[model samples]
Target: MLELGENPDTAYQKIKQLFVHLNLPERLWSLSPTTFSGGEKQRVNIARALSVDYPILLLDEPTSALDETNSKAVIQLLQERQAKGSALIGIFHDEHVKNQLCTRELTFGD
Candidate 1:
């Protein structure tokens, strides 16, 4: 992790811990690029992105294919990021997802 406040060592440790917290030990190493389910693959994607430690995270319909439980987990991870002073920009079509996660809404139209 190379973000402003996170040390690489600490970020790596946290990421490892998150994998455990998410109960994804088996999926962590065996996820094939073409064989992952949406939620499982999303977890891996989030892990990779967090490894970068960017101040802002942009997600495009991150939970689109996830079940309720997995979506909640991802939301919790976003909240953690917010607490760390990182900004998250998530693109989602699910009303429940936006309503639960965003403080303000941005709408667009043609």
Candidate 2:
């Protein structure tokens, strides 16, 4: 939220949207993320990282903990960010996700 600079309202709205898209209960918004499940915490981490309007994004296995539905939502969000000109650098092992979001592929080592 602090990363949003002067626009907190926008941040709150985005957070709410993320919580919904990630299937997090609205009741948990005020609670500490430590109380969340592994997948829930992962969703929170993803939401927080994406809340900021950064020129560059770095993600490592962003959907590893999520189910197919939630993973698709995250992919959509990342695609929107990409369309808005954020350069995404990610390590995704899921071939479907990789194919959907990566415009260029780089492989190291066999």
Candidate with top lDDT is 2
What candidate 2 gets wrong by more than 4 Å, as runs, is: none
lDDT of 2 by residue, 1-110 (tens): 75437477777787898889878898899998789888889889888888878899998999999999889888999999999999999998999999988999999889
TM-score of 2: 0.90
Candidate 1, 57: how far from true, in Å?
0.7
Q: Name the candidate that leads on TM-score.
A: 2
- Model 2 — which ten-residue stretch has the worst lDDT? 1-10
> lDDT of each prediction vs. the true structure?
0.74, 0.88
Q: State TM-scores per candidate.
A: 0.74, 0.90
User: Relative to the unseen true structure, what is the C-alpha lDDT of residue 81 in candidate 2, on a scale of 0 to 100?
Assistant: 93
Residues 1-110, candidate 1: write the lDDT tens digits.
55557787887687787776554565556556467666676777777776665799888987787778778887787778778888878777899888877776788886
